[model samples]
Target: MPSQYRPQLLGWIDDLDKGTNYLSGADDRLLYANDNYCAFLRKTSSDQIFYLCISFICIIGSLFLIPSLIYSLPSCNNKAIYFLLLAGLVCSILILYVMIPELYQNLFTRKGCPIIFNRKTNKVYINESY
Candidate 1:
């Protein structure tokens, strides 16, 4: 149904009725629909490759600090210094292992993202990059 109060020159979706959006196919944005739920793909960033390159550059720049971190490695005979260095190493490894993989997840988000809407709960669920 056409909106009775649509704005002039503005493409605002004033029509709350859902009877017109029936298109659904692989090439269409509408992915699925049920009695109380539906999903549609959203447009992603236009510069994904640019951001991916920047992400790689940032990762490489962060790695330059690794050499400096190991520069103060203690001699094998100093127990206190050795234990401190060991602890630092363990902490660094744990941090990197837990966080670095999260950076790769958004590299391809430019393709598309599915946003789900649930009428039963009147809520929306968005997919996180991580």
Candidate 2:
């Protein structure tokens, strides 16, 4: 029967309240929302848009490389070209499957965990339960 933890419970509640206050009334939320909006608008704020643009460029570049690889097939050695084509195809597929989805989720998804930022304490907390 070691369930008599009143003091611990009170402390936990206090911490929770403080965290809630910080998250609900901080500049960090506005910053996050602003950054997200800028990303959506394809505007410049930080390096996030640049990184995404670079990914897009890579995807397009890989697509173009495929055709170049095909065009050079007649003069190129069979085994080396085949391996290069295979590797390029695999990389393109991975970029489409893994990287794109993750980027989309990070930039778009807003229904899952609520990220809490405490500017007072400079702490960030994620509430995954809600």
Candidate 3:
């Protein structure tokens, strides 16, 4: 028999419109609560600064390395090895550029919290970088 799920690449995701499973975050995730409404943060409890910092460092390092590699290439002792090293750096940089579109927003411009819920309206509003 075929599986009920419409399986997709990378992740197995459910149809958002359907309430598929018994899922809820902990009370500690709550920001505030009252008679009218409540708000909660959906971000993971674990710190993500390290990952973001690493990506940021990669961006900075690539920017600096590419120029210096080019500048020193002509003066290097072994042209063949210099060209090979430059090719490696360029390929790595190309990979980084492909990843930039998503990473840039997360690294620099992600201002809003991950998610928000309102009991009064019985609705969820999401304004997340990811």
The candidate scoring highest on TM-score is: 3
- Ten consecutive residues with minimal summed lDDT in candidate 2? 35-44
- Give residue 17's error in model 2 in angstroms: 23
- Tens digit per residue, CA lDDT, model 2, 24-73: 32222222332112101112233345556666676677677657756665
Worst 10 residues of 3 by lDDT: 6-15
Candidate 2 residues lying further than 4 Å off, grouped into runs, are: 1-44, 67-77, 102-114, 117-130
Clashes in model 1: which pairs?
none
**Would you list the clashing residue pairs of candidate 3?**
none
Clashes of each: 0, 0, 0
lDDT of each: 0.54, 0.47, 0.56
Each candidate structure's TM-score, on Cα atoms with residue i matched to residue i, is: 0.40, 0.40, 0.46
**Tens-place lDDT digits, model 3, residues 3-100:** 34322311211223246642243443455545544445444333245556666777777788778778877777987988887896787688579556
Q: After superposition, how far is residue 27 of candidate 3 from its true place, in Å?
A: 4.7
Candidate 1, 1-130: lDDT as tens digits? 4434322211112122257743233344555566666666553343445655665665565466455457767445688877777777666666556446635755645244667778679888886555
